[model samples]
Target: MTASGDGEPRPFLVAASLSGAADADWARAAAPHVDAAVLGGVALDPVSRAAARDLVARGRSEFLPDDPICWIDRGFAALADAPVRPGVNVRSATLEPVREAAAVCADRDAVCEVNAHCRQPELRAVGCGESLLREPDRLADYVAAAAETGATTSVKVRAEVPGVDLVAVADAVAEAGAEWFHVDAMDSERVVAEVTGDTAQPRADLTVIANNGVRGRRTLAEYAAHGADAVSVGRPTERPAELARVAEAVRAWREGELPAGEPPDRSEASP
Candidate 1:
């Protein structure tokens, strides 16, 4: 399905996490329960080739083909036949490659995410990840360039990065015409709240997807109250049972049927 309509509470977003294609499978299995699936932190530069080579040299990422785009495409295709709206998060050091990658998503009818949330050392070293958090101007330019591709654009940002003005960053992205703002709220719902609030250049079409430690119906409700158009769960959704539980909570929260209480105990969700 296409993304949730404006002002409507989205079902839920399976975060752009690192669970291989298992996350996509979870989305497919949970299709009756959720709204969207963000596929990857797919690297969009030559460094991706090097990263793949390193993984190949280490006998890891074995399921990944040599081409990173193929790896991303395979993940996207998994959800193509499912009802969940698909999105792909891409990390890039420059604009040209982001546009190229966004084009790929446009062709597949998937939103392309500019990933400023990844803090991997290799990615940061090359200015592809959290590095963008330190450069809001460049991040705006990157999102603007990607938006020009005509694919729906989403900017995924890590909100707790020291010295980064997340609200300013989000405002820049929204002003650049990004359709969605995804904030990895880290430890602060306040950050998500501030970013989702009306800014000097607010776009009524902009949707906020809040990502972080969403444990149960209560937590999901909290994010929604804090202004999240949708709430996303990352690592916790890897297990089918956990995914089911979160899906149940999301459904309950959406219907205002969630039992009033503290957040559900998530002891078993830890890896």
Candidate 2:
């Protein structure tokens, strides 16, 4: 989805995982409903493995296809389980090990997002992913490097940053040829209430994707109503059947229909 300078409609990202084999299936099921997809993995690929071996100091964790690398195999395994073709909410971003990993996505015309939002400390000590969010210049540099690959580069980042305004940081990343702005919003009742009426400026600009604590149709609709372009979730819709239900709910929200009430009582769909 293209965004005008003043902000545009929200977009979607089928946030899935490398470890959760269900993500691929969920992605396939959710794809038709959303705008794009991001295959979230918590580890490093082989090349990243070598990079970590070289660059990381002692005790640094290797951020691979997943933070644990075990996630990579799981993610690929999930891809194997998909019945319908994978689709998603907004733009798609997959974990890459080297330029070649990016090339694979580019060759297939698949969108790959850089995982800069994960906050696991193992990744932080090594100076990758979420840790880099604090360094916009580094984040920008990473985006620039990813951009050079001829593959569309987008970043998944958290809402709060220590040094930069989350919104401003998102704006800067978007300005640097980054196509999608993935925002992981926590489930705060008061915050949730304000989202729908919070539209000001650039907030609407670009594709603003809301993530984090979305549980069921009601919560999904709440964010959509509040101006979310699309929403990427994990627990509530990780299976095909569940994804279908969630997708229908998302469609309902988009069309002006609201789910009966607030979202279901799901305290587990945490970040």
Kindly list the per-residue Cα lDDT of model 2 for residues 128-216, writing each as its tens digit.
55766677766666555555676565567765546746655665565555655666765533332233333554333445567776656
Q: Estimate each model's TM-score.
A: 0.84, 0.65
| TM value for model 2 | 0.65
lDDT of 1 by residue, 1-271 (tens): 1346432356555545552453466567656655667776666667654653455575543234456567666767878788777777777676787888787777777788888886756567777778898988899898888888887888888887889888778777888878888888886888877876774556556788888777677677677677777777776656667667777877776666755545444453355
lDDT of each: 0.71, 0.51
Query: Candidate 2: worst 10 consecutive residues by lDDT?
Result: 85-94
